[model samples]
Every structure is written in C-alpha cells, then in structure tokens.
Target: MNAKKLQKKIFPLPKQVEVKDGALKLDKVALKITADVHTAKQAAAVLEKKLAALGIGVCDCAKTTITLALGEAPAQVQFAEQGYRIAVTADGVELTGFGAQGVYYAAVSFVQMLDREIPCCEILDWPDMDFRGHVIESRLGSDLMEKEDWFAMID
Candidate 1:
C-alpha cells in the first residue's frame, strides 16, 4: 500500500447477515452521498453497481441535484483524487463534497482489506488538502489552457 496515497489504506466492512430497520426487515444495504451534482450522481451510480455485483442491495441516495460552489475548482475528478480520508462506517457511510470521494475509494479499499471470513469494522479519515485540481495553477487561464474563468489559482 502506498503510505502517501489513500488507496493504500485498508479497512474491513461489517458483514451484516441480518438487518432490521424499524418495523421493517431489510437485507438491503443503505448509502447516501451529501454532495453536489455531477460527482454525487456519478458516485451513487457507481456504488449501486458495485454493491449489486456483490449481491448487496443498494438502499437510496439522499438527493439528486447539487449546487455548484462559489469558486473552488468546481469540478469532479475523473480518475479519482488522492487524499488522506477514507474510513469504515457502522451502517454504511454518509460522505459529502470532495471528502466523499475519499469514502468511495475507501469502500473499494475495504473490500481488499478483509481476511478470510473477517467482517465488521469502522474507520474515520479526512484529507489535508481541501482543493483538488486537475490543471496546473500556472496554466489555468492562459490561451494555452483555455479553462473556465471561475477556476481558482492557489499560490
């Protein structure tokens, strides 16, 4: 595992053989991403597919639409971003914003973390850098780059 990169971190996800939600019994596994549009929807879709592959039912995502922020490199990372956050949760997890990406990576990481028949664990993590950028700050607005004007240039 790469110590500096988050994907290296491994943790276990609880295997709930039975789940009872209030008066209803649901073997269904629940999840929600409290984040903005594009990323949130994409993340929710990806998670649902992965869970189905594992034979686990995906519950539901919190909401559909997300509001764009003022100006914080307001775009989703295509190949995923590297950070210091990714943790296991009790039920599942509630991840939001750029921080939520970390959770997505962690869920995948948790799958790899399990030993033979091992189950039930939790983790708490967060990234140090708040801003995630795909382009170099210097090349942002120039004719060479031609990126959006709202993009921020961190010094």
Candidate 2:
C-alpha cells in the first residue's frame, strides 16, 4: 500500500512513517519486556488485556512477539519526553519509548494498528503539546457523572 493509505490506519497521525511491502499477522502473539524497562510491563499488561478482548491469545510459544523497551531514539531521530517509535515487521514488533508515558502511548497505538491489518512500517511520533485535557462544565450536569462514567471516558 501507499504511505497515505497506511497512515490513514493510525490516529493522530505519526510525525514520521515509512510503509513497507508486507503485513504482520497478530492472530497469536507474546509480549516481551526488555531488561531494565520497568514501565513496559505495565504497558504490556494493558496491551495484553486489550488484545485478549479482541480474541488474540497471549502465550509464550507464539512466534510473533511484541517487544517493549526503554531506549534512546536513533541520533537522526528527535523525540520529546513522551515520544515513541514502533517498528512493525513480518517477524515481530518493537516498541521503544522514551518514558513511562511514552510506553503507554506506544501500546495504545499498537492496539489501534491491530484493527483489520497491521502493515510493516516504522512510526516515530510525539505529542504536539505537553498537556492534553478535557473540561466538563458543571452546567452540563458533570456532577451526575458516575465513577463508571468517568472510567469509561478515560478509557
């Protein structure tokens, strides 16, 4: 597929992307956390749950493994505090993040990319702004929002 077509599969649009010639099959996969990457386990847990809900089994014997790690971007690539890079290939996927938040974001994107088909690509992305928030005015009956409602909104 073309670059634009592959990019359309992702939300918020990554800053840099290079589409490749093949796709990765995620029918069954494993989550691998690199050494010293503390936050990656939590992010992988979230990813595991998300994948399970979609009928994707997580097992140690799976051939396709999603590896998460905390590392520096290549010298040519510049990433903000919450930046991440995702490299998807036929063999597996590598998610490298700058921080804990970046790891979470990378997992989020990976989940999104799992819809339909996952093309082989490299994505380098970072938020344009430091803070993202949502405001609920009291006038709009925000007081009536329940705990479950808030959790759903956050999810």
Candidate 3:
C-alpha cells in the first residue's frame, strides 16, 4: 500500500514546519512525559492517560524515544498562553512549550501529527490570536430549553 505524505492541516498552523519522512509508528518507541511545575504535572498526567488509552507502551529506558516535557520555552515572553514547539526525529520526539496550557496544546498537536502515524518532522508554533472563546446563547423559542440540557451544556 502507498503511504500518506505529511500535510499541513493542523489548526492554528505552526510558524514553521519541515517534514522528513512519511510514517513513524508509535508502537516501538519509548515514551516519557515529564513536567517541571505542578500545573505542567497535571497536564502531563492527562497526556500520559491519553497515551495509555491508545495502548501505546511508555518507558523511560529505551533507545528510540518519545519525550514529552512541560517547561518554560525559550523566551517565554514570545509565546502567549497557548504556544508550543514539537520535533519528531529518527531517535525520538521532543515537545516544548511556555506553560502548562502551552504544553497541553503541544501534546494535542503531537497527537494530531500522528494522524497517519508520526511523520518525521519538526515544527515551531504559537497562537496567532491572543484570545479565543465562544458563547452559546439561547432564548425563548418554540422548543423550550430544558433544565437538564442547560446542566449538560454547563458541564
């Protein structure tokens, strides 16, 4: 079967991206997730849980690796609340961000990169918009808004 080429389809596109190869499966890699701060630790835990759910093995002692770390990115002043950089190499992968939220976004981006299996690549990214939020407003209508619906929406 033909392999899929890496394409730039990520949301809030990275500032820079370079693809080196087509596919890099996650099965045989040693995954390591680390956090430098409390919030980052929480984010790392979430990432680790997600990885576990995917049935991907994680270990700190392997030659081929996937290192997920949460720490202050170089020149933290440049990245806002949601900025990150991720690099996938022959040896392993490295994800870096400015804060906990940044690290979370990095993890998300890394997952997205694995759509067709991790492509050998490098990326530098940061949020273009300073703030992004949405509101769901409802008013009286033919269909009344149920209390249960409101509770679910809030949740």
Candidate 4:
C-alpha cells in the first residue's frame, strides 16, 4: 500500500507521515503493553479485539509484535496532550502516546490502518483542538435515550 493512499484512507489525516517500500503482513501477533501504563493495557486490549474481528489472533509470543506505550514524542516533534506516533515496519509496529487519551487514539488509528497487511510507514498525529465535544438534545426525540444510545454516540 502506498503512503499517500493510506493517508487518504485515514480520517482527519495525520499531521506527519512517511512511507517506505514494502508492507508488513500480519498473521498472528504478540501484543505488548508498557508496564505500569494502565491505558496502554487498555489500548492493547482494544487492538486485540479489532484484530480478532479480522481473523488475526494475538498471543504471548510471535514473530510480529505490536507494542503500546506512554512516552514522550521524538525530540523534533512536540506532541499535544493527546498526540501519538505510530511506526510500522518489517520489524514490528510501535504505537507511542504522550498520554492516556493519546494511547487510546493511537490504538484507534492502528486499527483503522489494518488490512491483509499494513504499509511500512510512520504517522504522527494530534487533534488540532484540545477540546472536542458533542451535545445531544433530548428535546428532539419523543422517547428518552437508552444507555446503549449514549454508548453508540460516544463510539
């Protein structure tokens, strides 16, 4: 997959992207989370579920591993509160986030890029605005919103 093509496929487009030759083919993968980072664990679990839906299994050991961690952005780049970097290569995929919210976003982006294979690339992204919200007006509907409706809206 071409980097340009992949970029177009991703919603809200990443701030920075670089692609190299070849792609990483995913079969079974090992998911590793940074110790002490509860958000990383949660992000890994979310990714695992998405992969399972694609018929890819995750386990304790594998040639290909996806790592989730909370860390600083590369020196040249200053990440916002919810910024993240995703690097995919023949070696493996590394998803690093600046915060808990960043970790969740990183997992979401990685999941979006999944297919039979992922293009070898690096993506740096963050929301333009620190605050994002949605307001649902109950007045428009005759019936009260169910719990599932709220969850669905959030998703």
Candidate 5:
C-alpha cells in the first residue's frame, strides 16, 4: 500500500505526519540500529531479532545507510510516558521518545508502520496523559457484600 493509505493504520494517531515519495524497501536498504540508553538499546535488539526473521540484519559498519536510533527524545518534545515520534526519510529512520517506555512505544509504532507496508513517512505523537482508568458496574456486588461490610468499611 502507499504511505498515505497506511498512515491511518497507526494507533493513537500521530500529532503530525508526512508521507514522502520514496519507500524504504527492506530488501534494498542497509539498516543499522543503535541506542543511547539501555532500554532503548534493548528495544533495538528486539527489532533486530524481528527483522532477522525476515532475513534482514543490523549492521554497524560505515556502509550502513539506513540507521534506526532508539533514544531519548529531545527535552523540547513533551510526551512523558508512552509517547513517541517516528520519522522515515529516504536515507534512514529515526525513532525518539521521552524515555524508555516512550522509546518502546516508538518502536511499536515503527513496527506497526512496517506491518502496513508504509515505507516512507514521518510521525510526531504523544499521549495526553500518563495514566488511564476504566470503571465497570455489576449486580453481583450486592451478593458479595453484606450490610455489615458496608457499615464496617464506613467506620
């Protein structure tokens, strides 16, 4: 699919995105991945393993043209948790986040992008909040709790 069509496939849509003209064909690119922190490094390793399954290997030599950086996002970028940015250019892919968790999410987004065959695109995204909560109601609560329980708890 073309990059434009694949953009919508990403979850929690990126704040900004740009689809470029050229695609990063895995078969034609020499991909290299590196990270500045341990967490990001581990994430890169995970990506390495996944790509290996597809017969793509990571390189550290000078010939490496497509570099994937799993690292902390610059301080200016605001997403604190589970927020990330991914940019895919003709020459390389750069993934950044506020911290380790963000870095992981960045990788996740990248993988999602790849899954959709979206080869050339740029994305800027971040979560609005760090915590999420959900509530559920059930009639079984009445059977499980006694009046004494409610009075004792109230005390």
Candidate 6:
C-alpha cells in the first residue's frame, strides 16, 4: 500500500490527522537490513515486506553480521533457535542480527510495529549500542493486535 493510503487506514479519523513536512526523510546513506544466516525463507519474506512497509530497503542483500544459538543460551537470557536483531542508524535502519528464535520473534514484532506502507522515503535512526537485541513470540500466527477487532468482525 502507498504511504498516503496507509496513513489513512492507520489513522482514519479525519480530524485526528496531522501533517508534518519533514516527518518522512530519506537517509543519504542507504538503509541496511542485514541478517545473520537468516535461514528461513518464509520468515525472511515477511521481514522483507515489513521493512519495505517501513520505508526501508536493503542497500546490499549481502551484509555480514552475527548470530546466536537460542538453545545454547539460558531461559532468563533472551534466546532463539536463531535470532532477529534490527537497528536504525543515522543513515538508515539495519537488520543487524537474526537466527532461529530471533527470526520468528522479529517477524512478529516487526509485522506489528513497522509501518507496512511507507512510500518511497527516508529515515534517520541509530543503534543504542553495537550489542544484542531480541524479540519473542509466545504464539505464532497472523493475529496482530490491531487487526483482532477487524478479524472478529470477519469471523
């Protein structure tokens, strides 16, 4: 969907709409959505769509990064069969990391969070630290919260 169309869908009430000129900025440097051995093609597909929706794209489909074994890590610590770590920097957003569990969790978080309809635009973001980031999914499905109400009506 286009950004204008998306904005309308997300914030429907006409009165509540507000426009800002600089709200959408494209980074001079390309956005890098990298993943560490992002093995699952299905999961990767979802991530690709989500990033595009967020107005971010891969500068180079091949970027080197890291991966962590979920089973090897303790429960108290964030773990994944694989991991999914995404970051935003001054230049653009980065898919900094991912693995088994991480990929699954990142899919859920991103589908829910990233704007799924940003038109050709730019963004400025940065990683808090060159460290670890994690996302967790208790249940897996297309049950995004915002769509629950819409789903109920359809059902």
Task: Give one digit per residue, the lDDT tens place, for model 4 in 1-155.
Answer: 67788888777788888998878988889988883567777887789888989998788778898988877866555445588989999878998888888888888888888876888999999887778565775536588788887888779
| Stretches of candidate 5 exceeding 4 Å from the true structure | 1-4, 28-34, 61-78, 115-118, 132-155
Ranked candidates, highest TM-score first: 4, 2, 3, 5, 1, 6
Listed in order, each prediction's TM-score against the native is: 0.38, 0.76, 0.65, 0.80, 0.65, 0.33
Stretches > 4 Å off in candidate 4: 74-79, 135-155
List runs of model 2 lying over 4 Å from the truth: 35-38, 74-79, 135-155
Which model is ahead, 2 or 3, in terms of lDDT?
2
Using TM-score as the yardstick, the better of models 4 and 6 is 4
| Alpha-carbon lDDT of model 4 | 0.82
Q: Is candidate 4 or candidate 5 better by lDDT?
A: 4
Clashing pairs in model 1, backbone N/Cα/C closer than 3 A: 14-120, 88-123
Put down candidate 5 lDDT per residue, 32-145, tens digits, no spaces: 556466667666666666666676655655232444454565555665656677877655677776666777777777766663134677777777766644534333645765
Q: Which structure is stronger by TM-score: 1 or 5?
A: 5
**Which of the numbered candidates is closest to the native, going by highest TM-score?**
4
Evaluate model 6: give its lDDT: 0.37
Instruction: Report the CA-based lDDT of candidate 5 relative to the real structure.
Output: 0.63
| CA lDDT scores, all candidates in order | 0.37, 0.79, 0.65, 0.82, 0.63, 0.37
Query: Candidate 2 on 50-155: residue-level lDDT in tens?
Result: 8888888899999998998877755554445578999999999998887777887888887777743578989888877788565673336436877787777769
Model 1 stretches with alpha carbons more than 4 Å out: 1-26, 60-84, 96-155
RMSD of each: 12.7, 6.5, 6.0, 6.1, 5.8, 13.2
Q: Write the per-residue lDDT of candidate 6 for residues 1-155, one digit (tens) a residue.
A: 33344334431111112222222233212222333444434455665666566665545442321112122322423333333343322233333223454544444443443552223322111223345456344345986545565565447
Clashes of 6: 18
